[model samples]
Target: MYGQGMDAAPNPWFSWDYVERNWDEVSDRLVIHTTLTLQAVLIALAIAFPLAVLARRIPRLAGPITGVSGVLYTIPSFALFGLLAPFTGIGRTTVLIGLVAYALLVLVRNILVGLQGVDRDVIDAARGVGYSPCECSSPSSLPNALPSIIAGLRIATVSTVALVTVGVVVGYGGLGQLMFRGLQSDYRAQIMTATLLCLALALLLDLVLALAGRWATPWLRGRAS
Candidate 1:
């Protein structure tokens, strides 16, 4: 469609000229997309961390909490957006709600597993050394759990980045909006640019999180070495 011609058709692939012409608009959308993704991840972490701690504290409740989060994760993005549109009105709020809900399952499960994995003897050792409950949990247990927590964070961050693209229908999608417009106008350059940007953003965020994880858990690196 983009290269249709009476005699000879032009190439329908990506065009650097088109990208140069639309660079400003694309850059703006990229910022918005990155901001929205990060916001969703931070909010989800705030909600999930406390619940994860609760699940660790009360072993019996862990299964039910996980089951609930799993159910939330299974809801289709479009369906969730539709459901929230009436209450929140179609915008960033609706998009964020959907993203945060999806992130909770992964974040909460990983945190709970991390905390639970702490050895009982190590916890006792902390207490036996005159460590207060707070110290025992935070300094001792939390550091040990950092690996799992960071793993969950990495997964949630990448997943949210991808999901943000789905928000294009509700008008909150960053690059997704570009992709949708490109499709309607049969612009291969725009489509290719948006898709590549999305991939790049996801990879960039994942790499940053991986580095942060390594920094947070130096002991793991030491053990590996």
Candidate 2:
């Protein structure tokens, strides 16, 4: 139907003119998007590690801690922005806070699971052989758990990249801002560009994390060989 409409001038989805005219805006948005994704993931990782370790250390608190994270993850992004805007005001900070909160559930759970998965006997043996708690955990537990923690990082980063677009609601959604405007104006090119860039960013981050995981866990490769 769209192709048959010869009465209207052709409106293509790929327009060099669009990129040329809005190069600065698009580039700025991409940088903002990357900044938001990176900062959120890093902050979440910092918070998650301590929480995960605490949960592992204290078996009684593990369920409540993870349950709270699950609750945080289930809150809709827009709803989070709405709730935070009144307190933090509409800005990047609000979005960053929400993104970090969303990432916590995945990161904390994965780290906890990985730590739990490490064989108890390994730790016991290390303790029997005169290793301190610090040495046993660092050399024995965390390394074995590195794969799961890395997996969580990859998942959280990709999820955060996608979620950052929802921040357009608070006027700081990075590329999401472009996509929102495009939607309002029915600008297909802008919409496609934003969508594609988001996907590319997520994929790039995931690939990097995957490679990092493989490098961190060389024993898996050695075992297979």
Candidate 3:
């Protein structure tokens, strides 16, 4: 009877049966995980892009601004989330605050580098042609900077997706919750599934962003050709 009971026990390492049984739940969690990641990245981009532009315009402040964001990035995500719990309570808001902080330094530095990389000759020509400040910066400067900016986005996004798993400590960690539950219950299938899903999500997003970047900068293709 003992031998039969042991044989009847589900395999801990891998279980297509578990996945088949829980597909709906897995899908829902995946959607939540993806949404949270995208929200954090977009918010970081919104904050970082303008800051990078301002830093470019005012070179004197650039060092200090990047320094501050770098410090924020250095603070551990768990510590950041814990600190924010008092002010924001334990939830998506706390996770977002931490994720955005981590993303800023990378995004800001890349954007500034991209903008600064733009040719002086290009700017001069744009100005010579009666381009307004907005046109000169946006139409002339931004397109050239797109590749760098997209690179930053890809890095920020993948990093955010990984960090989102950390949020499970606070009950807002999307797929992280599944991982935590699996760990608590000693369910290997749940842990493995969540981990594989996170990896797949990250890879898929990176590919999509890469393609989008290439599409946005058609000249790069032309230049390569």
Candidate 4:
């Protein structure tokens, strides 16, 4: 019996039926990951945009904010989640927090880079024409900065997709669940399938974003787009 038990193993990577049998689970997990990533990216954007604007005018605030976000970027997903588990507890909230922290650097840096890339002459012209800081920052600076911001967003989108897959380590609502099951059961086939699916999704997302960015920002067609 012990010998039989040892011989009975899970082969996730090679198991087509494994994936087919759990299609609903895989689809649900994908939805969860998508929602988590989008929400995290959007929230990070909200926080980063204003900070970027502030950084442009203040100059002093930029360094500290960038430094902090950079640090957040360096923290490993599992470690961050583990650390947050105490304060935030487990499940979706903790996962969301971790994803947001991970995204902060990409989102903030992009916003800052976009703002910094704005044409000095345009800004100067806006100021000279009696445009308020708000006006100059919005319609004027924004247009020039759009491409850089979108570029950053493009980067963020890719990062977000990848990070969302990682969220499964938290054992909640991600493809990670499938991945974890495969690993736990020594199911290589399922594992391979899950991994490939994730890779495909990430690649597809990058392609779609690239197309959208190019369409949205004509200037980026050369570099930014």
Candidate maximizing lDDT: 2
| Cα lDDT computed for each candidate against the true fold | 0.88, 0.89, 0.88, 0.76
* C-alpha TM-score for every candidate: 0.92, 0.91, 0.91, 0.85
Whichever of 2 and 4 has more lDDT, that candidate is: 2
> Candidate 4 lDDT, tens digit per residue, 188-222?
76677777777777788778777876676676566
Candidate 2 structure quality by residue, lDDT tens digits, 91-144: 999999999999999999999998888888887988898987656655244588
Candidate 4 lDDT at 36 equals 81
lDDT, model 4 = 0.76
Point out the worst 10-residue segment of candidate 1 by lDDT. 133-142
User: Comparing candidate 2 with candidate 3, which one achieves the higher lDDT?
Assistant: 2
With candidate 4 superimposed using the best TM-score fit, by how many Å does residue 103's alpha carbon deviate from the native? 0.9
Write model 3 residue lDDT over 1-225, tens digit each, in one string: 111355566646678888999999888889989998999999999999888888977899899989999999999888899999999999989998899999999999998889888887887888898886556666245588888899999999999999999998788998998899888777889889999999999999999999999999999999999
Model 2 poorest 10 in a row by lDDT: 1-10
Lowest-sum lDDT 10-residue window in model 4: 1-10
The alpha-carbon RMSD values of the candidates against the true structure, listed in the order shown, are 2.0, 2.7, 2.8, 3.3
Q: Rank the candidates by TM-score, best first.
A: 1, 3, 2, 4
Better of 1 and 2 by TM-score: 1
